[model samples]
Target: MDVVKPKNQRSKRALEKRAPKLIENPKTAMFVRGGHISQIVTDVMTDLCKLKRPNAVLYRKKNATRPFEDPTTIEFFSQKSDASLFMYGSHNKKRPHNIVFGRMFDHHLLDMIELGVEQYKPMSSFTSIKSSVGIKPCLIFSGDSFETEPNYAKLKNLLIDFFHGSDVERVDLSSLETVITFTVSDGKIFMRVYHIALKKSGTRTPRVELEEMGPSLDLVLRRTHIASSELFKLATRRPKALKPKKEKNISKDPFGSKLARIHMTRQDMKQLKTRRVKGLKRKRDTAQEEGEGTESSPKRQN
Candidate 1:
């Protein structure tokens, strides 16, 4: 005798079992290359740190090793509790300037959970992950267009502010193409812009790719990377409307003094007087009752 099975039930069971296995072993991982990639990752990681209730780790490799080789992995991992939005950064010497950004299918940090390691353990509760990845800092700029000298200078200043040091040696510009690349140290972070242009014809809005970079950074430079974003023209546009000045004769009454005055007319005063009279009458009645009770009470025996 043969047992009959429903096709959909079997499919669902198979998927449930296979999903975990796939997550346990991810097939495709992000890869970063070039000298500025490390800095890009650093900047991105810095921003990730700003998230609330976040678990982030940053680590550098002790010994240099080849890419995809054992003992050569440097990585950063970040996750929120019970969330399937884990962000990972992986790097190695073979890809010295190469960095990889990845997300767990479930974003639950199941790899650590499976290993029985608590999220961001052994470090301060506020500490990000301590990975073996080395640091490479670089300047990143985004704007509507870096084509003009002034615009380029503005972008340069923004980058200078972002990296903070003269260590930024390579500059990658993809603003015109709505893309940005920053390479510093041994890592790189790439950003793709998405939004309205700040300028009518020369500005752009930017969207920081949080998941694309492996880690979070303190400061990430996301300029208006569009060709015509309002912010792009903000540096050049005239104000459409000026704020009105306060009138010297106008009183600053938050409680609407005019309305209050209107409500405090003679009729209102009469009603208030009536309320006070009633309140006093009630008080007098209470006093008279207390006096009568005192008089009626028998004198205490000596």
Candidate 2:
């Protein structure tokens, strides 16, 4: 006997086999290279530290230009620190204050996202100004184009991962006060933060609204590498069964052997007419009657 599978099943199996596996324990490691250090890099590091990750190491390389020039250097530091996520920062004339966020699969660089800061502001520059800034409480993703856009989904997931940090918790949305919202339109990813707000009306429940917050970033994402989707599938794959399930004989009827057709033909003409009428009248009932071959005798003789 030959077994047949649908087109989708075959394609899914092929994809799963080629997928990259995600690291179980994602240890993040950062390397700050080159002479001039930007404040954005330090701010990002501070944010990472605030996340309180279990394992995160930061390395500084002084007076060197283009620290990320060699892939071997990255692999060297990755293996030495055993980190699955790496962040590289450098500054130069062409693109000042550049940061590269990348992930590793099997100790190899799998995907990278590079973002360059067009403007700069140091924390020391604002020290004299008597003003305080607070983190936002909400995020919203919008745009009519996102309904059919594919990259919209990818950017949404990335934003979630970026804001939630390494360790994510599945809890009440209200608990995650810091909200990150993405609005995609005209081939652009617009990220905005908000604070959840409520407005009161006459004898009615307060209308919920989102108030825009500050420190908004319009990041131009340059995808250096495509992230492996295989890691997630591999992590979720079920172990193969030790042995195939045993097939058991399923008796079609509970009583005994079915009566032969010849024996059924011996029924009275009136009963045959009744059965034929019954079969033609209700389609479902006829199918059940024919399938079971229920006894035609008015009274079953034990």
Candidate 3:
């Protein structure tokens, strides 16, 4: 990885944007296509940029670069654009309608996965309700393979970083109008984007329904570059300030209520020294009290 020395104020600001922080900025992505691309590849890139609007950079002209052979160009672009994520599409005779999704760590290729687009339907094909641009999407990864299989797990992580949108502290149901579901089955990934429908549930919480919006795809997994455990751990390291501090004898419940343990010394019931009622007193003390009361009352009567 080559580091760029900032010469001007603008370059310094750009470098500062890439610096690690407690609340890092949203990751930008550069979308590039090879010199030879098919209609499907074009449509796929277009729809993806639509989904990742404002944060994505679309190259108008085609470029001749193979990431697997020489990734120097992509790395340079990553640094130039200040984009940590990228999507490259290429349609060749050998591999038709191919798209490579990748992530950059320190402006260098950390993960690059080749996915062969088998069946694709652009968002324009579906004339249904579309989500508003720049709205954060809810990502769901389903199927046992995504969790159980190693390759699928890496793919899952890549997809999440690609479409996670802006980082936020809170998530409400109203903001979750868009959902992108990725299902892995039979060694193929099925991707579907849906617009959430909130119906009248006759309560505060609305009934939720999923309506397929578009850009549906069936992708067959191809070559991949999954980072090693050590490298991945390093890449995923977070600032200590952002990490939740461990609180001893404290915990949180489902509703996020703070719960803490209260330690107290054992109490001795006998040492309470509370006053007792005359009816429950000892017989000798009770008799003396009664005799004194009778004597006082008789003298007053006389």
Q: TM-score winner among the candidates?
A: 3
lDDT by residue (110-184, candidate 1, tens digit) is: 111000001111122223232222222333554434434443444454433322322334644322211224332
Q: What is the C-alpha lDDT of each candidate?
A: 0.32, 0.53, 0.90
Q: Which stretches of candidate 3 lie over 4 Å from their true place?
A: 1-11, 199-207, 252-259, 262-302
Alpha carbon lDDT at 168, candidate 1: 38
Model 2 root mean square deviation, Cα atoms? 16.0
Per-residue lDDT over 1-302 for candidate 3, one digit per residue giving the tens place of the 0 to 100 score: 89768999998997687787788789999999887999999999999999998899998789999998899989999988889999999998899999999999989989889999999988988877999988899888889988888888888889988998897778876877788989887878899999998889999888989989989999999988777888889889998888888889998999999999999999998797877877668899889988998888845454
lDDT of 2 at 158: 42
Of candidate 2, the 10-residue stretch with the lowest lDDT total is 127-136
Ranking by TM-score: 3, 2, 1
Candidate 3 backbone collisions, by pair: none
Model 1, C-alpha of 164: deviation from truth (Å): 31
Q: After aligning candidate 3 to the native by TM-score, how far in Å is the CA of 149 from where it should be?
A: 0.7
For model 3, the local distance difference test gives 0.90
Per-structure clash totals for the candidates: 52, 8, 0
Q: Quick one: best lDDT, which candidate?
A: 3
How well does candidate 1 score on lDDT at residue 105? 29
lDDT of 2 by residue, 1-302 (tens): 88544479877775554444342333455454546667676564444333324445677554344434556666667776766566677666676667676655556665566666553333333322211223223446787655565444554544444434434445544444345566655555555444455567665675666554433445555445555588645533654553446544433356785433322345575555444455367788777877677565366589
Please state every model's RMSD to the true fold in angstroms.
22.2, 16.0, 4.8
Model 2, residue 100: C-alpha shift (Å)? 1.3
